[model samples]
Target: DQQVKQNSPSLSVQEGRISILNCDYTNSMFDYFLWYKKYPAEGPTFLISISSIKDKNEDGRFTVFLNKSAKHLSLHIVPSQPGDSAVYFCARETSGSRLTFGEGTQLTVNP
Candidate 1:
């Protein structure tokens, strides 16, 4: 079974709106969670991250929230832009360099 999962395969939003992406993990051993953004034919780039100890973390337009009890995490993007449209991936990192990523959630921002 996959340790991490993205429940939503895709999301569509209008420009200047909010985009919410969700993720869940079955393993409690994950120490950190990260969100990555990827474009077609390009490598994924790190977007945001939050430690297991932290309930929430925010950076500019992006915010990440972790609910340890539920083993769930969510990413929020305010004023979603067309440029922000891409495949968003949620990842869990262990003590080692290995990062387990959830199936990506594709976000489309329509103008």
Candidate 2:
């Protein structure tokens, strides 16, 4: 079974604070980890990604870390801003056709 789990459906953080989202996967075959940020009805845009070969990947304010042994991953947003408020989805690409996504975690950046 391919199941990606984001236990927290939502999270709120004050602006300029750190925001962290966690995800877990049951499938061991997953090799590509990705995080996508989405606002409202718009399609999700890629934020950062890490292959099973890497432990971490960072871009600007977004950083993702993967622990293959634990089958867990997390996304960290440093000094989050109001504009950063959105739904973050953690996904694993295994089959090459599409990614298996977590339920989603809504990050609210409070001003």
Candidate 3:
């Protein structure tokens, strides 16, 4: 069973629009949730995170909302730009120190 799932492998949207990425988890024990953004060959960079205790966290153009009851989380970007195009990965800090990551969602922003 996939503890974490990114239902869609890719998403495309026109520039200056809203881009939403969704994630679901089967494990309810995940305490720390994070979203990372990666470009091409580089490693993923931390974007936003929400603790199991909180419901939402935001940074600049990115926002991560966690609904603990539903075991779901989403990342939203507004006025999305061309530079925003990249592979986004949702990760969870499980009981183990190593992180568990989603397969990833490739976002394509049309210029």
Please report the candidate that would top lDDT against the real structure. 1
| Higher-scoring candidate on lDDT, 2 or 3 | 2
- lDDT per residue as tens, model 1, 5-58: 998999999999999999999968767899999999999999999997899999
lDDT of each: 0.93, 0.92, 0.90
Per-model C-alpha RMSD:
1.2, 0.9, 1.3
State the lDDT of candidate 3 residue by residue for 1-111, as single tens digits.
438889999999999999999999996776788899999989999898889888988889898999888889999999899998999999888766578899999999999
Which regions in candidate 2 have their CA more than 4 angstroms from the true location?
A: none
Task: Rank the candidate models, highest lDDT first.
Answer: 1, 2, 3
Model 1 scores worst on lDDT over the 10 consecutive residues at: 91-100
TM-score of each: 0.96, 0.95, 0.94
Clash count list over all predictions: 0, 0, 0
Worst 10 residues of 3 by lDDT: 91-100
Pairs of colliding residues, candidate 3:
none
In TM-score terms, candidate 1 sits at 0.96
Q: Which stretches of candidate 1 lie over 4 Å from their true place?
A: none
lDDT, model 2, position 94? 70
